[model samples]
Target: MKRFWNWNQDGDQRQLAISGVIAPDSWIHDNVSPQVFQDELNESQGPIDLWLNSPGGDCTAASQIYTMLMNYPNDVNVKISGIAASAASVIAMAGTTVSMAPSAMLMIHNPLTIVGGQEKDLDHAAQMLVETKEAIINAYELKTNLPREKISAMMDDETWMNVNKAIELGFADQMLGDDHQPTDCYSYSDKQSDLVVLNKLKRTSQNTISVKSLQKRLSLLSH
Candidate 1:
């Protein structure tokens, strides 16, 4: 069986890299089980630096990993090196401090599951999904402190965030650098309004703009 997580000793800190789909060995036949991961984590020494890059897979596996990390005695700092999407985003919330590379991406969306049965079974599945989404919201809320309503809406929209947006929304604490911090140049109560302005600038400039530049342009527009 292949391991989903890789652990390497780096001086006083242990570096853990979590890449690819998250699933139990029984499901994938080649993926590491959560218990196996727990065993490795239990044996580790010093603080952990976790590097995440996954498209997400089983929610149950993610929840187990998240719980394990949350319960670990040492600090676990998560660094998003590529993308953390869907169930992987939930696991990312276990970090004591989360950081993202400048071009890394973070995505969140409503939970989905397949059901096969009669109408009653379908109804039960729907309820399960709803409850599952709320559980995911709990993780995001704990990390970002964003309102549940907003987080739900964003999930409904299948929100995708770049490093700047992740930091702005508190999904990530900072950019990966010695002096990087969350961008605070602009704030908007309405996400739609923010998107409109961002879309307008994208069209006008025919390119992406930095948060600082966006702030300057927004200020000019207000004046």
Candidate 2:
């Protein structure tokens, strides 16, 4: 697996880019293990600018990263430059100042599991999933302060939020960087191919194009 954290030094400005899947082997090549993340976080000090572009993975792994960030005795600002979905959204909750690029997306959903076993085994798995869902909700509740029922309903629907909605819903705190500039371009895994259709990027100052618009454009392409 490729190491996901690295220093990007531009003159005196430094930042760590968390720019892919959250857990080991989420994709065939790029994955971040908890050990790898811990090692990187420990080696780095002072103020950190964390740039996120992830579709999320491995809730336990994300939770560990979130805890580590929260415990670090330094200012850590999170900037979502592309997409922060699932477990990635959970990690973003740790930011002292969480921000989203204009075109970035944030998604949240109930815990998911795939299982096939005896009835008792299935029952146990279901119970575990329920506990995990609650834990995930706890992170959102702490960050958003929205009613638990509302949050739960959104999660149940696998809701997708763009930059404005993310901030409005309390998933993010601010809009980061130059507003005129285009958000960073990223590629989702083939697993997400069915959801994201590849389209040539189109941007304009007259209108702010969003992920939802891109999805609609892609949907049109498919038909």
The CA-based lDDT of model 2 is what? 0.72
- Per-residue lDDT for 43-108 in model 2, tens only? 756767889999887777788888888776666778999999999999888776677887889999
lDDT of 1 by residue, 1-223 (tens): 5567899998999999999987734343434476678899999657899999999888888888898887777678889999999988999988877778878999999998888999999999999999999999999986776899999999999999998788778787667873432333223244424433443343335336664587577767767
Candidate 1 regions exceeding 4 Å error are 24-32, 178-223
TM-score for each candidate, following the candidate numbering: 0.78, 0.72
Q: Please give the RMSD of candidate 1 to the true structure.
A: 11.7
Off by over 4 Å in 2: 9-14, 26-32, 178-223
Q: Output the worst ten-in-a-row residue range by lDDT, candidate 2.
A: 196-205
TM-score of 2: 0.72
